[model samples]
Target chain A: MDTRERLIESTRELLWERGYVGTSPKAIQARSGAGQGSMYHHFHGKPDLALAAISRSAEELRDRAEAAFTSSGTVSERVAAYLRREREALKGCPVGRLTQDPDVMADPDLRAPIEETFAWLTGRLAGLLAEGRTSGELHAGLDPAATATALVAVLQGGYVLARAAGSAEVYAQAVDGALGLLACHARQEPSRPA
Target chain B: MDTRERLIESTRELLWERGYVGTSPKAIQARSGAGQGSMYHHFHGKPDLALAAISRSAEELRDRAEAAFTSSGTVSERVAAYLRREREALKGCPVGRLTQDPDVMADPDLRAPIEETFAWLTGRLAGLLAEGRTSGELHAGLDPAATATALVAVLQGGYVLARAAGSAEVYAQAVDGALGLLACHARQEPSRPA
Candidate 1:
């Protein structure tokens, strides 16, 4: 990859691994194999480079979610697929992890992508749930938007729980619990054989 | 407060505001008015001091949660009360935030309290849920352990979302969503009038 791409990729990895406050420009230079002059020539400073990296991570997160949302299946099934998708639970989320970084959260430019990414995710899930309701896949009592937010929260929170325990099992159990609760809202198929 | 207490309290605050890597011993001294010698006398160093602070935070977190779990109400009502409890959403959870800190997670000593606190919380919630099942207040199909894990995850994730958005409303909405899902599992009383 080119220096610019390499810098952004390295920044993304560093940001994910060490967070904003923990990640330094010198570290980024070391990881990317780019000198101080090259780093400054490519971007204004840490925040500017970080913004580019964050935006990239946000877009990738959305794309990954979209793949699950658009995949062939019932709404509930698709949601399940998204939740059950393989992940590095111990490593935490690339975009979601940024929320814990005080430096990232304090700056509007650094915070925007994280905020927008979640908004888009919750919005997308809500739309899928609304579709489920329309197609009689989910019960009428289900609130699409609220349920969507809860699901997203479960995924994000699952990372925290798993990381805390140093076990991915905690994350899987959390997802199972969410799926079970969601199943409680699924409409029973009248024609299906017992 | 005494020098030791002040040091612990200040460390707690700094750990909450800025993570482990960001919180320096010098900053802790500055915040607590404890000199280097006093700090060293009280604890070995940064990691040692952080352990005490983290343990204190963990205990307080459990205490706060216990209040909700033990509140006088039906199972669903108590759960709702817990979800609706007021909080400093932007600040995030004291224990949960530590999961994001590399230094905290890297050291088993620092990670112990966080892991145990969440384990205790989930276990407590699971016990409450099982009680609900025994009383027939909730459906038999609900898995108490998994559901409890999800509930805790929702809370942790809610903080992440709210902090990212720079709005507590996001946290409130996520809680509302979880509550809505939970209400679906409540057993209907045939004798009660609508």
Candidate 2:
């Protein structure tokens, strides 16, 4: 990758591992192999570089979720795929983890990507559930938007539980629980054999 | 409060705000109005003091959750109450947020309280769901342990979402969604009026 890409990539890794307050410009420079002059030449400073990195990560996260949301299946199946998709549970969500950084949350520019990414995911998930409801796949009582938000929350919260316990089993259990709730409302097939 | 209590309290605030890596011994001393000498005398160092603070926070978190988990209500009602409890969503959970801190997660001693706190919460929630199943309040298909983990995950993840979007509305939506799903499978009482 080029110097700019290198800098952004390094900043993303550092931010994910150390958070904004813990990550330093010197550390970024060293990690990216971009000297002080080159680093400045590529970006104004740490925040500028970080914004680029966060935006990139946010886009990647949204794309990943979109792929799953739009995949072929019933609404619950697609959601299950998204929830059960392999993840570094111990490492946590790349974008979701940014919420823990005080500096990232304090600055509007830094926080925008994190905010927008979730909004997009929640909206897309809602759309999928709406489709499910229209097709009579889900119970009539289910609210698409509300259920979507819960699905996203469970996935994000699963990472926290897994990381805290130093085990991914809790994450899986959370996902299974959520999917089970969704399945509870699945409409029965009109002609299927028992 | 005594010098030790002040120190622990201040450390808790700092850790919640700035995380373990961002907090410093001098900063803690300044915040607590405790002298450098007094801090060392009370605790070995920053980690020791942070451990005490984290342990205190974990205990308080458990007590608060226990109140909701054990409250007199139907299964969904209690879970909804737990999720709906007023919170400073932007600030995140004291113990859950620590899972994002590398230094805390790296040290077993520092991580112990966080781990135990979540385990306790998940187990208690699971027990509640199990009770609901036995009482015929919830669907027999509901998996108590899995659903319990999902409930805890949603709360923790709700904080992350609220903090990211800088709003609590989504948090409420997530909780509503989880509770709504739970309500879908509520066993119909033959004697209850429609």
Candidate 3:
């Protein structure tokens, strides 16, 4: 509603569409309908505003994934829900797409949110998987940490495939592949007493 | 190298480091030690030169993967080799990175090499996997095409994780996770009679 909020929202949208290098302060100002003075007053500069925007996106991403993890289901089912969650596949992950931006990766201030978001996702997934193993939902030998990394990779990499091919089917195919892999680890349901 | 070759190589390096948006003709000229006239004479402009560079990179990428694929080993071993092949993980895939560039994706000519590279790679991986199933080296029920998509996604997504985390460890972890999943589908070696 206010100048600060409008500026941050605009920057986030631009970053998703064009990435860091392609996005400019001028463009942000144009998108936000804010004057140069207003933008400078709210934030020190482009990086300052970008840091705020990235942090907000990161939190939102975490919350979205958290919701998926907490959803009622088996661990794999929850993970599938997260993977199968609707996404702008061709547009790519708002947070993951930032990794490709050299400027975003170069500045520690800019990179922190992106890095933290993934680390948290991987860790949270690992925790869920460890729980699955303990409850006999997954094979006992399955490594929670490693499998979590795989899950994260599938989501991120699926975007790459889908975007490169200009087709959403590749993204879905990749998701199916990952789900199939996870299925390999499924523990058989307990046999019913005759 | 000749002027044309130098220009292409420089464009390739610039594209990898800065992407299509960040890279410019002036930067390409500085990197290649070519004059503006020489650059224009050899190619129409940035897009023309970029196409050549991307095509070359695509070929090199194929050669690199083929080495790992064709190496002496079983199906899983070869797939593992391809996955484990050393790379500049933080820099990301030369071709895969382009998909994130709006300019590259918008221009069908520029996108051709990148799209073809991944398509060829997924198909090749699928072929190898199908062979493994036929030879009983992998699970009979495994879907080779889907598994191949998973493999490609792991590599592409692993780069995103590594770059964002500013560490190759996540990439390696993701790869290991995917490989671990593949190992689940391994058919038991036939027993020998005493």
In order of listing, the candidates' clash counts read 0, 0, 0
Query: In model 2, how large is the Cα lDDT of residue B170?
Result: 81
Runs off by more than 4 Å, candidate 3: A189-194, B189-194
DockQ of each model against the real complex? 0.59, 0.61, 0.52
Report lDDT per candidate: 0.91, 0.88, 0.91
Report the lDDT tens digits of candidate 3 across residue range A41-142. Answer: 999999999999999999999999999999999988898899999888999999999999999899999999999999999999999999998999988878
Task: State the lDDT of candidate 3 residue by residue for B119-142, as single tens digits.
Answer: 999999999999999998988768
Model 1, B1-194: lDDT tens digits are: 99999999999999999999999999999999999999999999999999999999999988888899899999888887788888899999989999999889999999999999999999989999999999999888889999999999999999999998889988988898888778778788212111
Docking quality tier of model 1? medium
Model 3's CAPRI class is medium
Per-residue alpha-carbon lDDT of candidate 1 for residues A1-194, written as tens digits (9 for 90 to 100): 99999999999999988999999999999999999999999999999999999999999899999999999999998999999999899999999989999999989999999999999999999999999989999887788888898899999999999999999999999999898888878888322111
Candidate 1 DockQ vs. native = 0.59
Better of 1 and 3 by DockQ: 1
Highest-scoring model, DockQ:
2
> What is the lDDT for B137 in model 3?
95
